[model samples]
Target: MTSVDLHLEEQSMVVEEDEFREGEVPKRKNKKKRSHADLGEDAEKRGICYLSRIPPHMNPSHIRQILSRFGDIHRIYLVPEDPNIQVHREQASGFRGKEFSEGWVEFSKRSVAKRVANLLNGEQIGGKKRSSFYYDIWNIKYLRKFKWDDLTSEIANKNRIREQKLNMEISAAKRERDFYLSKVEQSRALNFMQERRKKKQKTVGAESDGTEEPKVIRQFPQNRPVADGGAQTKTKLSKDILAGVFGGGS
Candidate 1:
């Protein structure tokens, strides 16, 4: 399951010291509260965030210690469960493939995370390339506005706020256009159907009155084909029918 942190926002600090007596713990101090700017600053300074293409056997503490030389570590955690846990566990001998080992160290400030990241990102470490560990595939990004969560909720909220107004405008225009076009289409279709029905009614009425329409005979131009002797033949017209119809050729 993907874990996400939400409820991050720019909030004003309220001084509520009067609610508690002198002996009682302050409510503000008791609650674990941190600001976006504070987290961002901490991540920048102390975060030596990295993803390693190594085995779980490789301890995270050793890597953490190495990173401590660069800056103070607020907290370090290894992604305990693998996303491909099921597939890998199914194979024999633990699949013998690389696992994702990520490391994060919260520096004292943003400058430190930046400085260390810039210096050691492409630099060598532990006799091999520093990239041999988790530094390479780290989904490391400097969160500019840490007050907002790096999650779908935050993204969805921003998207909804932005697109809600725009989408409504588009939807309204689309509905109006569809209604207008549909009316025009319906009118045209109705007119065509009505015209066809009228023509059919007329034809039926005429047929019922026994007034048969005259049939016109058409004459087609016929070209004579070549005879077996290899000579083209001329057309032999019906003289009697032609004379009766046209009153022409002697």
Candidate 2:
């Protein structure tokens, strides 16, 4: 096919003289370039292809060997149906291993893909169709308007954005919870300290009230008269002082 037929856009191409008005300068026209991937996607939109119940041993080489007889294959992809699944060897010696998967095969011609599906769907891979042992068959279906990478990437991006938002919300909630818990702890500590101080004050007040005694005021004579060698006259004894000393009645 010619380069024009391939529809490969140039990043910048000079405009033809006819594209411009007469006597005008031929200006460059910048065009959105198409990559090989874009071309492949555009071509893939024309075909139909899908395979089911693909065995683990089935690879691209196997598909080429099997389907190339039918037509030219544009692309072949055999992917695991579940990543967590393990294809284990059989416990019995010499027994084979098998794992199930799905696949897609695009053909260069749309008609070839449709014909292949019609001929191969429900066909046994291991034996003649006349035998009962040929029960292990493959299922094939035609896919329409399916772009593998675009759909998968779109889904992955959406999941990534959703996970990020959820993580952010969880982090914010945790911070809020921690903040309130700290406030509650501080309030509890403050209340405990206040109660302790009040109890101490009450204990101190009770002890002081119970142990206190009243003070007594007493009168004493600063000057004293001598008795015998420094004897004092009997009339000199103070009447109020004598009453107190002898427990005399008033």
In terms of TM-score, the best-performing candidate is 2
The sequence of per-residue lDDT tens digits that candidate 1 reaches over residues 146-237 is: 32223336546755786898899999999999999999999999999999999999999989786887778999999987679664465667
Assess the local accuracy of residue 77 in candidate 2 as a C-alpha lDDT between 0 and 100. Answer: 53
Give the clash count for each candidate. Answer: 11, 2
> Listing every candidate in turn, what is its Cα RMSD in Å to the true structure after a full C-alpha superposition?
20.5, 17.0
Top lDDT hit: 2
lDDT of 2: 0.63
Per-residue accuracy of model 2 over 34-85 as CA lDDT, tens digit each: 8999877668644647887675455454565567688866556554444235
TM-score of 2: 0.40
> For candidate 2, what's the RMSD?
17.0
Residue 68 local lDDT, model 1: 58
lDDT of 1 at 21: 31
